[model samples]
Target: MIRIAVIGQSGSIPEEVERMAEEAGAEVARRGAVLLTGGGSGVMEHASKGAKEAGGLVIGILAGDRTDVANDYLDVPITTGLGFDFRSLILVHSCDALIMIRGGNGTLGELSAAYMNCKPTVAIETSGGWAEKVKQTAFEGCYLDERRTVEIHYAHSGKLAVDRAFELLASKWNEERNTGVTGD
Candidate 1:
């Protein structure tokens, strides 16, 4: 199944931002994709909540060894003992695509990792935080830097962001298939 990770802050997010995160999770579930998260509160908790409500599998890539610290909605808890930064890389590598919501420094690092790994990422611009700031800071409004590793897509809502991510994944798959490349 397509695994989609939702990266965002770990603190108290605004109600509207929470709704967006939940909607993104719900949409991911509705589309028959698994939900992956950092396994903390705020965006992670809400996304897990939505995915569970929609009968979707939810995986939490946790930073520490305590599975109890993860949100209750997780179907599986991957306790990496890698701490936040390193575990973040595992999360990036494990998913087919990512949806970035309102985030802080950690989210910024994940965005950079996604770009470096050439993973498709969609930022919900209306959710504030890094998701909104990235558009203004990115090169040509899509690339994260001069390297231009990959272009990031922007959406106004959670549903749209998830949709765009899937579109990106499909486009990449089609490109590889058309080129007759077996692996990318």
Candidate 2:
């Protein structure tokens, strides 16, 4: 199973963007993909709700040991108790891929980490927050960095973003197959 981490803001956001996030989550579930998120409120909550409605397994990388903070829809809550900052790293590291919704600075940090680790990611570009801002912040008005470590797939709709995410995963898998894993 390919784990997909949905990174985005945890507070107030535009209703349209929130709906997009919800649709993204629903699409992931509809495709039989497991949904992963920071497990807080706002966009995370919307995504989880959509995924659960679609009968998908949802995992929450919670910031604390208590389950109270977790959204109502998570199937499994990994209570790292590591506090927000450290747990965010856990969220980035455990996933096979990431979907970036409209997000804040925290989402920016997740994007940076995903790039540093060469994780495949998709971005819903029409959403707000960092989704709108990051293209400018990235190097060469294109990529996150010179390493080309992580390719950001952009889509105008939630369903399209999730679709592109799967494409990215397929491409990455193909690259690994063709080049072969080096450690062996």
RMSDs, each prediction? 0.9, 1.6
Instruction: Report the alpha-carbon TM-score of model 1 versus the true structure.
Output: 0.97
Please give, for residues 1-184, the per-residue lDDT of candidate 2 as tens digits: 7778888989887898789888988989999889999999988999998899988989999989999978899999999999888888999899988889888888998888888877777888788789878877777644787867656767888888888888878877887789996311
Candidate 1 residue-wise lDDT, 101-163, digit = tens: 999999999999999999999999888999999999899999988988899999988899999
In order, the Cα lDDT scores of the candidates are 0.94, 0.85
Angstrom error of the Cα, residue 24, model 2: value is: 0.8
lDDT of 2: 0.85
C-alpha RMSD in Å of predicted model 2 compared with the true structure: 1.6
TM-score of 2: 0.94
Cα error, candidate 1, residue 170 (Å): 0.7
**In model 1, which range of ten residues has the least summed lDDT?**
175-184
lDDT (C-alpha) at residue 162 in model 1: 93
Q: How high is each candidate's TM-score?
A: 0.97, 0.94
